[model samples]
Target: MKATKRQYAYYTGMFMILVVALYGIFLLTGKSFIWEGDGLAQHYPILEKFYTWLHQGSLTGWSWDLGLGADKLTTFSYYVLGDPFSYLIAFFPKGRLELGYNLLILLRLYASGLAFLFFARQRSFKPASQLVGTLAYTFAGYSLYVSIRHPFFLLPMILFPLLAYGIDHVLSGKSWIPLAIFTGLALISN
Candidate 1:
């Protein structure tokens, strides 16, 4: 028997609900309160330094003495560009940055799921095939591994399918500059 449209929507909704519940459980059981590795906190100094820079107009980097000769400030320099996300994080109350980061994780997971669904639709998969494809991506091994490691890396993975779809739309000559800028912003946003 073929699944009706309502049945498919029900299945998709249930799957999304389950994904969110699983993500919450996963967040609760992680090694650290925020699930980001030790290297994540290494940016704290830079965060403080950025707040100082905002008020003082200093041009120096986070710290010349912080890390090893070459590797010390490399990670912090990732934010040296005008990305305001970190600044936003720093603006919140001192103890609430973890909450902010946790919200970012949830958003990343949702975006990853949507990206998988877009990919499945692009492939014209049958309902079951699409379900499998979405599940494969949204719950893949890398998801588990990344949860314990550099969790933010998921942002790029989440944007991959959507960016591909937009680029394809542009290359088909239906549109150009919008997709180009969209993809470029996705790259820069990370």
Candidate 2:
């Protein structure tokens, strides 16, 4: 189904409302989204290191920070290096990483909704059904569970719908490139 501008606007607005409804309390109270466990002790620090590296324009070599020193790129590659969204951290100033971290989680969730919408639209789902499915997929229990505690996991969730759409394209006698590209992205995102 061809989506009109009005439908796009409606979907976008609805997505924002859903996000705000779910997370607005914390925002209003100025509470940190960091999960106090792995999020505070591990993820945020790793992300701060990544930000420092990016800000310094040097993402190579060893760092003593990782327990008596480790290869910077190699260590980070297991965490943020492969996720494309992690690169956005460079835009956040040094002191405001916590805010950036929280905002990025929201952005990732929104992107997940958009990915699901793209898949539903490609499959010709009705507009209302598309909206419902997008919202459900975006706000699913697993998605919410991982958003704060394991934000990188959202990368796979976001890519899964696109990968499914690419599979549809290939099965319908289209070029295999889309499937291949999506597969590569899904793999690299992890």
Candidate 3:
């Protein structure tokens, strides 16, 4: 069931439109599943502390005392959870919170699209089948389950398909540029 190039292109385009629509609605409604008992609030301060570390490079270890007060990282593990995008957002003119969220959403979409393209290029499945498979991988029960319970994991999930596709292409004797670019993206996406 080999998928023609044109069919793959069409399905990929439609998926992009769907992703954009969903993301736009989420942004406009300012709706998030975040809740008070969610523990997200507890993490905010740790993120702020990491942001400080990204800039200062002096705030290492579990806890450190500043001149004014003592800071504790008792529950915070900076290495695993630190987001580099925090530093990138500081360059934005607008507020960091909104900008950072928007950036994350955009990156998610781009990664999904790249993954779809890679799926289409596989050439083993029909174009329609490839589209359905990619979308299933992107929005299926597992994805939905993760999105609800451990949403932050979505970033790496979005990235996984693209990285797999890029690797597949490189293995199939395609150009190195796509693989190289995706490798760089995977590295910087941390």
Candidate 4:
């Protein structure tokens, strides 16, 4: 189904509204979204170090910070190297990393919804049903759990629907490029 621009806008806006509704309390109270567990201990610190390295213009060298000095790229590749959204950290000011981190979580959730919408459209689902599926997929238990506990995991979740759609296209005898691209992205991201 060819989605109109208006439909795209509607889906995007709805996703934004849902995300804000679900997470607005943090914004309202000026509370950090960093979870008390892995989010605080692992993810935020990695992001901060990444931001620092990015600003320092040296993301490929050894770092004394990683347990008595380790290879920066190899050490962080599993965490942030391949995730495209991680690069956005460079744009956030040093003092506003908490905000950036929270915003990135929200952005990932929003993008996951949109990715699901795209897949649903590819399956020729009705517009209304697409919205429903998108919301359900975005707010699924696993997604919500990982959003805070392990934000990077959301990347794979977001890619899964799109990968499925790519597979469908390939099975329909369409060009295999979409499948290859999404597969490559999934592999690179993780």
- On lDDT, the candidate that comes out on top is 4
lDDT of 4 by residue, 1-190 (tens): 4556667788888877877887788779877789999998999999999999999999998878899999999999998999999999999999999989988988898889878888888776787888888888998899888998899989987899989989999999999998999999998998
TM-score of each: 0.61, 0.95, 0.54, 0.94
lDDT of each candidate versus the true structure? 0.59, 0.87, 0.55, 0.88
| Local distance difference test, candidate 2 | 0.87
After TM-score superposition, the amount by which residue 54's alpha carbon in candidate 1 deviates from its true location, in angstroms, is 7.5
Deviating ranges (above 4 Å) for candidate 2: 1-4
| Candidate 3 residue runs with Cα over 4 Å from true position | 1-16, 23-25, 32-39, 42-45, 58-62, 65-94, 144-149, 162-190
Candidate 4 lDDT (Cα, 0 to 1): 0.88
Tens-place lDDT digits, model 2, residues 1-190: 4556656677789988987899888889989888999998988898898898888887999888789899988888878999888899899888889989998899999899888888888877788988888889999999999998898889888898999999999899999998899899888877
Candidate 1 residues lying further than 4 Å off, grouped into runs, are 1-16, 19-75, 79-92, 127-132, 171-173
> For candidate 1, lDDT tens digit of each residue in 37-141?
443664334555555555555545454545543342355546533343444554556565566555545556656776767656656568677776776787778
**lDDT measured at residue 131 in model 2 versus the true structure, 0 to 100:** 85
Q: What is the lDDT, from 0 to 100, of the residue 139 in candidate 1?
A: 70
lDDT for model 3, on a 0 to 1 scale?
0.55
> 55, model 2: CA deviation in Å?
1.1
Q: Looking at model 3, which ten-residue stretch has the lowest summed lDDT?
A: 74-83
